[model samples]
Target: MPLPELSISDWQDAMAREKWTSADLVEGFLAQIAALDSAGPCLRSVIEINPDAMQIAEALDQERQAGAVRGPLHGIPVIIKDSIDTADRMLTTAGSLALVGNHASQDATCVRRLREAGAVILAKSNMSEWGYMRSTRPCSGWSSRGGQTRNPHVLDRSPLGSSSGSAAATAANLCVASVGAEVDGSIVRPASANGIVGMKPTVGLISRYGIIGVAEPQDTAGPMARCVEDIATMMNALVGADPKDPTTSRCNARPMVNYRKMLRPDALAGARLGVARECFSGHEGTKGVIETAIRALRDLGADIVDPVQASELPFFGPMELELFQYGVRANINRYLSTHPGAQVRDFDELIEFNNRHAADVMPYFGQEFFELAREKGHWDDERCLHIQSELRRLARDDGIDKALEKHRLDAIIAPTEGSPAFAIDTVVGDHILPFGCSTPPAVAGYPHISVPAGFVNDLPVGLSFFGAADEDAKLIGYAFAFEQAVQARRAPRFLATKS
Candidate 1:
């Protein structure tokens, strides 16, 4: 009953038979992680293995035997991005040395939901340093606490980030699924690079109570896994209202727990889909793959409109960065104030810590963004106050919302990232300019999901489907259908090992 290539639903169905149990799956995956992380390919995707993963899995199996099935996620083993708080044995460091010994005092709201749904938190995955804001020079997967997490497909290339290990671990089948949080390109970019499904749920859709700090306006935890079905299944557990953060409560219009049921094979059949011009302008290989994806949508009977133009405002670029910097200092400061045991107290203290431990903390890169952000005033400042409202208004109302209303479209399609992961460069920062698929949805705080479309020169590529706010299900449904129709996903071969 065990399928070595089992997905979330596939594994659940197989486990329904008495012959299959969570322990079997856990054992199989633990072996997989050991082989990949230690011996076979030597990936550092798993930052820390949960010592009690098997114990938790065995307990869940017993609960099921006692007629207490939790739901789709019951007994499913999933790794959490280092940024997500587990409130368990694993330290939630977000791949930073400063927080190495810190354990979350409480489970992040999203983590609690997964546990409530009976999913076993398997491990803590590696990530970009301080979720990629600390310094540009550090490699995407080379965190101070956990070294580089190589791409499962090709060891030398990137698996993308700041959710680097989440994408690699999920794509490599080290876990049944994993959760990845995004601030702009973190989830979608890595998903594209690793050939998995990366969903950036609408801002406030999932509670960020225990998640490590980032720019809240553009930050959200979503599913990063092998297929669209898995992403939807994980999302069902992750999305909800939380009292700790009023934003989740304010997202009254957010989708409730049934994302998987919304997947219709014909979801794209009559939908109006736009071809994002910006997403394809630069990279030839990526553009070709996206064009092919668009053609597939057209074959599915979608009306594909190319260059359905939307607003690109005067203050758009600077405003997004501005919001992120202001939000980072404010939110990280707030998180520190609440969680006092962490080594660093404020952004300034974090800077001091990095200076004190520069060899380990800033070995490869300096915190240019952090220094710049520290100079910016708090969210309450006049410039910060004026810009935050304007940024959200412009990104949401004048951007994605405007495009959808003007085109009368249900969704838009774009290359999830410009291309696949570039070679890891410790001295130089990320070369991520080609992302047409990320910006609007990321900036707007709307939902966007990327599914594996194909590969270019053996590296992964992705196609993104995004829509206006409260349309998480629509994007998921369309991406699922497209994935089904194409079946383009393939596990990374790393390299054909032949002497």
Candidate 2:
């Protein structure tokens, strides 16, 4: 039987009408993963499938039959990046072999929330080892535990990382939606490259309590799905203040609006959108696609601010790298220390473990970035503190804020990435074009979303919509409008290679 291209609401309606049970949904997805992920294309997107998923689905179905739906996400299947912790049988290794046997003592705040909302924890997706902070020339989805995750659109093309598997799986419809974490481009880039909807919510909006850390200041987990409505559906379950993560305290004070309700088809009618033209200077094919998308936005009533050059701001890249180094050393250690029974206790121990197991762990690339981070001082060191302050000021106040304030814009639009999926080259490493606009909003701790824009040579490209901190609702509205107007997303053909 051919399953429909079901959204969250569609799945809910199906269940409500007795067309499918939660167990049926889980089994269907599992079969797809076996056929598409494991044997057919060998996408290698999933690291570990939850052994208890079907049982959980059966229980959820029983509950639903008894007149109790947990919430909007009741019995929804969700794939989460491996970096996020779950207390279940799955290992939270972040794609590293060093932590192969490591298990979390309890569920990460995000997982707990998802479970409470009745989202079935389908599986853990592969990722760049340690969120791509291990080596300078790291391959996006090449992990020791789970090998390269191939893009479903073109089997040999790269699936952008560190959220590579999440994006790939979602685009392939292995699950209804997937959760991904991003420090810079992990979520958006992969979603853009794989042709899906990826949201990197404001850093504090989603709790980072159980997620493997890259940089606390910039790291966040959000939804990757086929449509903006599905992304919003996941966001509705993801948002809320968590006592475990202090950063979410501010979320409580803010107005709690249904993100799904904010999706207005006419949202772009009077909205001012700034085009980050500096980011538009990449592959001509990608540029042409994004240019067409921009024109479509204009045709749909958006007030387009063309050629906005916020990418020219100084001190953004250097400061961000410095902060990441410090964050890797400090934040990772903090997570390791809090979680007991871990094979490695600190970053230095991790380095030693990698060296000891170099044959399996460091087969292709060395941990040069980890070594560099190890040499960095504490997060509170005078130099580190100074860099953090300057990064926020430059990226937020002088960068995105300057552009937004000057144009009185509601959001900024750019190519989510410079180009479509590049060929995977293990020897020379990822040749992906460097046309990312994630740095500014990432450093600013703001929200950003990537919606499928169009195709470049049969490969997917994404259009980015970003906004000021805590303006997640507004950005969602704008992205929804654009997504509905453009209707650019196409189902993946699972080609053997780029045609």
Candidate 3:
């Protein structure tokens, strides 16, 4: 039997009506992974499957029969990015071979929350090795251990990263939903390219304790799903404070939000949404799609503020890269210090490991970023501190804030990416286009979401909605409204390549 394109709510209803059990869903998805991921289109989205998934689902099924349901995600199967430590039979390698023998002593805070809320850890999705902190020129989805993840829409097209597998798997329905981490465009870009709903919530909204990362300040894991409602549901479970991660201290003071309640179809009515026109560069097809999206917003009773003063938004490319290098050295070393079982326990050892095993790990690209990070000074160094302060001031205050304040806008909207998926080019590395809106939200540590806008030459494009920090629920409401109005997303056809 073929699986329907069911949302989380649909699956809940089906289980409640006795149409299917959690085990049945798990078996079906496993079969699909075997057929589609490994055989049919060979998307390579999943790095590894959880051996205990079916058994866990069976246990959940037993609980359901006994009149016990954990919560909204009771028995839901969720694929998490490889970087998230699960302390299961699965290895938390971050799509790198150096940590192949490593295992987490305990679950990552997010994974622990998901499990406690009755979400089955389905699989570990592949990602860019070391979260793309290993190389300046690297393929977005081509990890040393997991190979390349292909776009389901057009096989040869890029899936975008470092959350490529999570987005691709969610779009291809390999799992009910997936969690992906991002410092920059990792989550939203892949979500946009795969034509799914992805939200990079306020950095502290989701704890970063157990997840691997390149940067501490900006790194966060968020939900990617077929619809905004599903994203909202996942957020409710994922958001919480962890003592190990000091960044989530802000969440402790606020009561937990019922994100699903924020999902009103008419949420866009009378909302002042500013268009970041400067981020609408590159492909005309993508611009055209976003244009139609803008009109749809207007039709839905949104007050469109076009050409917001975003051209003045500072681009912190060089400084951000420098900070990432410094952070990779600091954060990765800290993580490794805890995971003593790993072969390469420090940044210096990791660099040496790659040099010793260059044929497999460095076949496509060298670890210049790793080398750079190793040579960088401490995070508290004068230059690093200056970089952090400037990033926040420019990206947060002078950037997104300037536009919203100037236009009296509720949120800012733009093309999530400059173009649709480009052809996957391993030799020359990722051809990521300019004019993406991910940088501001990423650096500001604010909330940002991407909803499928429409197709550009049969490949998907996404519209982004972002604003001030801690306004995640509001942004979700806007994206949900837009999503319900246009309903632009369609399932990928699994074409070998764009015609």
Steric clashes per prediction: 1, 0, 0
The candidate scoring highest on lDDT is: 3
Q: Pick by TM-score: which candidate is best?
A: 3
What value does the lDDT take at residue 413 in candidate 2?
Answer: 93
Poorest lDDT segment (10 consecutive residues) of candidate 2: 309-318
The sequence of per-residue lDDT tens digits that candidate 1 reaches over residues 1-499 is: 2237678888888888776799888888888888887667888899998989999999999999999899999999899999888888888888888887778889989999999999999998999978877753457888889888888877778777789899999888889999888888789888988889999998888988888757777788888889888888988888888988877985565435588887788888898997767666477888888889999999988998888754353312677777767887887788778677789988899889989998987777888878888988878889877876777777678777888888898988888777676776677866666445687788778888999988778888899898887789888889988999999899777662211
Q: All candidates' lDDT scores?
A: 0.82, 0.88, 0.91
Clash-forming residue pairs, model 2 = none
Instruction: Provide the TM-score for each candidate, comma-separated.
Output: 0.95, 0.98, 0.99
Candidate 1, residue 71: Cα displacement in angstroms equals: 0.9
In model 3, the runs with Cα more than 4 Å from the true position are 311-316
Q: Of the pair 2 and 3, which is ahead by TM-score? A: 3
- How close is each model in CA RMSD to the real structure? 2.3, 1.4, 1.1
Q: Which ten residues in a row have the lowest lDDT in candidate 1?
A: 308-317
| Cα-lDDT of candidate 3 | 0.91
RMSD over all Cα atoms, model 3: 1.1
